[model samples]
Target chain A: MTPSTDAPHSCTRSEDELWASLGSPPDAHELQCLTCQEQRRRLAPLAQAAQEWKTGTDPEESLLEGILGRVMHGIRTEIRRGTLFTLTVTPLGPLRISSYLLLEAIRDAVDSIEHVELRTHKIIPHADDAGPISLAVSLAMQAGQDGTEVAEETRRTIAARFAERIGMPIGTINVTVEDVFQ
Target chain B: MSGPEKPDQQQLGNLVARAQSGDPRAFEKILTYHQRGLLRFCTSMLVVPGDAEDVLQEVYLTAWRQLSTLHAPEALGTWLYRIARHRCIDHLRKRTPQPRDLQGPESLAGDIAASDDRSGENPESNAETNAAMTDLRRFVHELPANQRECWVLKEIHDLSYADISAIVSEPIATVRGRISRARTTLAERMRPWK
Candidate 1:
C-alpha cells in the first residue's frame, strides 16, 4: 500500500521552516502533519531552556556589583572633566562651575519642591560671555497634582535657587511636564 | 521566570538626557537597569565569564563618554546593545581563535536545581533538567559566532528582529535568517533529550 502524500507522517517541510513557523500561527500544512508535530515536541525543551537562560539570575552578582562601582567612578571622573560655565565674575576672576555642579544644583532645587521631580535639565549660558543663563528642565509630577501650578512653582523655585545658591541670575526658566508618577 | 521590567521609553529618554548633561546618578540608574542583559549578551558571545565582565565595563564606559553622540535618546537600549556587540567583536578579534572552555555548566545546573526545588520537583527530575540545560548551553556555545550573537540577542535578551538587526548591523531579513538557522541547529541537537 502506498502512503498518501497528505499523510501526517509524510510531510517534507524543512526543519528551518518548521522552526520559523513556530514563531507564527500554524499554517494549514502544519495543522495535520505528524512530522511537524514531532518536530515541535522535540523543540519544546530547547525553547524552555532558552527561557530559563534568559530569566536566570547571574551567578556572580558580587562581580557585577564591583563592575558597577568601577563604572560609576569612571563616569563621575569623566563628568568632572566636562564643560564649565561662569556662575559669576568675582574680583579674582570668573567664578566658573563645572556642568556637573550646575546640574547638581538644579537637582537639589527641584528636590526641594513638593510633588515635582526633575527628570532632566539643560543649562544654556549666554553666548556673549555674560552671567545670565537660560534653564530648561523636564519634570515628572506626582499623580493628581495641578500641572500648571506645579510648573509655575518649579520655575520660580529654580530661579530663586540659582540666585541664592549660585549667586547667578537665571534669564528664562522653562519647565515641561514630561511624565507623571503615582 | 521573568526579568525586571524595563523603564518606559519616556523615562529612559529622560534618563539618557540627564546622563548626557552630566548627571552621574541618572547614568548610574541606566547602568543598573541594563547591566544584567548586557552582561548576558557579552557572556554568550564571548563564551567566557571574565571576558564578558571586561566587555561589559568597557561598554558602559564607552556609552557614558559617547552619550552626547546618541541623538535619539529613546533608542538608548539598542544603542547600548550595539556598543556591547561591537566591543564583543573587537574582544573576540584580539584573542587567538580556539575552542573556548565554556564556564558555568555546574553553576547553571545549580541554578536549575534551586529553581526546581522552588517549583516542588524531585531531585531525579532536577538532575534531568540540569543535564538538559547543560547540553543546550554547550550546543549554543558551539554555534558560529554570528549565529550565536543573533540568537542570543533575540532569544535570551528578548530583542525584536529589528532591534537585533540594528545591534548586529545586519538587515532584518538577515537577522531572522540567522536566528532561524540557530533554532534549527539547537532543535536538532537537543532532539535526544525529547
Candidate 2:
C-alpha cells in the first residue's frame, strides 16, 4: 500500500514520534515535511537566548523590603489621621458584609456625630460561614468621641440595620477607636 | 481538578481580601506568603533582575489599588502572574540593543548579553546561534496570538494547560496544542543542544 499523507498517525506512535522529531532530529516524516524541517533548522539561537535569560538570586532583599515598608508606612501615617483599629475587607468577605451593615447602622445611629471612617482587615476563611472566613479584617475607625455610651448605641443601630438591610447573616463587626483627631 | 479544600488558594484569597479591606497586617501576610515566589517568576521572564524588581513593585501597587476588581478570589496568584508576564513583555519591547563588544572571558556577567551562544563552547560561532534564536522566537511568536498567549502563560508562569486556557480564553485542546507546538518549535531549534 502506498503511504498517504492523509493517513492518521497511530496514537501510540504519534506522541513519541512527534516529540522525537522535534527533540532529536528529522526522521523520515519530519525530514520530508517542509515545516518541520524548517523548524529543525532554526532551533539553535533561541535555545541559546533562553539559556542566557538565567535566573539568579543576586537581587537585594533590602530593595524589596524597603519599598514595601515605605509604602506601608506612608499609608499608615495617612490613615492615623482618622482611626487606629483599621481593617481591610476582602471582596465578598464576612467583615465586608458586616462593615457595610455597620456603616448603614451608623448612618442611622442618630446624627449626634458628624463624620466617620471605618476599615476592615485580615480574613480567615470559614467552611460553613463560621466566625472567620479565611480572611481577617481590621476595622479602623475615625469617629466622634463616644465611650461605652456611643459603642452601645452604635451596636444597636448596626444590629437593626443588619437585620433590616442585609438579608444574609453576617460574621463579626469588630469596632475599634483608631483616632479622635480633634 | 480543584478539590473541596483548595486550601492554599483559599488562604491566599482571604489574605488579599483582608489587605484590600485596609488591614495592614493582612496585607503584610499576603506579601510574606507570595513575595519570594513572585520575585523568582519575575526574574525568569525578564532578562534583567532590575526590571523584574521594578515590575514586581508595580504589580503590588496595582493590586492594592484594584484589589476589589479581582472577580475570583482564589485566583490571586494566577492574576499576579498574568500581570508579571505582561510587564515582562513590556520590558522586552522597551529594550534597546547595545553595541556588541566582547567583555573578557572571566566575567560571569557576560552571560547576560553574550549573544555568543547559550552554551558558549565557541563565542565566534555566535552568528549561527543568534540566527537560530531569532528563528525560534519567530516560529513561537507566529503561533496565533492566542496560542502564543497560552504557550507563554503555561511556560513562564508554570500554569497548567487548563489554567492557561482559562486565562487565554481558549479551549483546553487549543492550549495543549499551542504548548505542544511551542515545545516542538523550541526543541527543533535546540536539537543540537538536546
Candidate 3:
C-alpha cells in the first residue's frame, strides 16, 4: 500500500512499510528522514505502554480466586459426569446416575446395617456384555456380631438399596468381612 | 526450538511438570502467573472485563485437564495464551459483549495504569504517563479484534512474531502487517492529544 500523499510533516512511506523496516536493518532514507524519526518517536511510547500494561491491569485477587475455585469445581463435575451409568427400564425410560453416587449409596446402606462398618465398595458395569452390575463391598463386623449374619445382612441391604435408589437390578452383591472391630 | 534457558521459562517448566503430576497447587501457580496478561488480551478481545475473567477461568480449567497433553512444557505461556485466544474468539462469536466504556473515575485511571518502574521517571511525570497509557488502553479496546490481538500480544507480552502467529493462528507476515497497521491507527488516534 502506498503512503498517504500528505506533505512533509508526515512520512511518504506507509506505517506498514516503516514497521516492516523496523524489523530489519535501518534504511538510508529512514536514517536521513525527519518524518520517519517522528514516526519512531511516536511508536516508542506505545511500545513502552504496552510493556507496562502487562503488570498494570490485574484483575482483583478475589476474582482470580473465585475463578480458580469455579474451575476446580467444574473439573470435579466433569469427572463425576464421566463415570455416569445410564439405566434403561423396560418401557419407562433411561436414568443417569454417577458410579460414585451409586457407590456412596451402597456404603451408606451397608454402614447403617447392624454391627457393620463399610470399608469400601466397587461397582463393575458390563455394558457391552449387557450384564448386571457386580458390586463388591468390604466391611468390618463388631466383635460380638456374627460374621455370617452381618455379611448376609450387608448383602441384603445393598441389593434392596440398589434396586430402590438406582432402580437397577443387581447381578451379585459380594460382601466380605475383612476386619472385626472390638 | 532449542535456545538458552530463560529464568521464567525454567520456572514455568518446573511448575508445569509438577502440575502434570497431579499437583493442584502447582497448577494454581501456573494460573496466577499468566492470568494478568491473559486477562488483558481477553479484555481487549471481548471488551468487557467480566467476560475476560470468565474466559481466562475457562482457559485454566481446560489447561488443568489437558496439562498432560501439552508436549512442550517450556512453551506454557504460549499454550495458555493460545487457549485463552480461542476461548476469547469463541466468546466473541457466540454473543454480544457489553462494551466497557471508559467511565471510571479519573483519579482511578492512574491506579489502573500503574507503572512498572522501568522508566525511572518522577512521580509527576509518571502520573502524566500513566494517564496517557490509560487512554491508549481505552483506545485498544475500541480496536478491531485482529489488530488488537496482534498489538497486545506483541507489545504487552513481548512475544516474538513467531509465537504470536502460533497463538493467533496467523502467518508471521500477516501478524507483522496487523501490528504495523494497528500502530498507525493508534498514532493517528493519539495525535490530537499531543
**lDDT by residue for model 1 (A101-153), tens:** 77788988888998776777988888885657888898888899999998899
Query: Candidate 2 lDDT, tens digit per residue, B1-194?
Result: 11123336535554564566655555656665556656655554554447767877776666666677777767776676667666666766777733321222434334323423554444346665554444444345445544555555564444776766665556887667666666555554344332
Candidate 1, B105: how far from true, in Å? 15
Clashes of 3: 0
lDDT (Cα, 0-100) at B77 in candidate 3? 80
**Each model's lDDT:** 0.77, 0.50, 0.68
Model 1: residues with Cα > 4 Å off, grouped in runs: A1-32, A87-95, A115-119, A126-133, A138-151, A168-182, B1-3, B98-124
Which CAPRI category fits model 1? Answer: acceptable
Pairs in steric clash, model 1: none
Ranking by TM-score: 1, 3, 2
lDDT (10s digit) by residue, model 3, range B1-194: 11124335545555565456444556666776666666667777775557777788878887887888887877788888899988888888887543343445533335334433334443247777676677677777767889999988987677899999999889998898788767776765544334
Better of 1 and 2 by DockQ: 1
- lDDT at A163, model 2: 65
- Each prediction's DockQ against the real complex: 0.35, 0.12, 0.13
Query: What's model 1's overall lDDT?
Result: 0.77
The predicted structure with the larger lDDT, 2 or 3, is 3
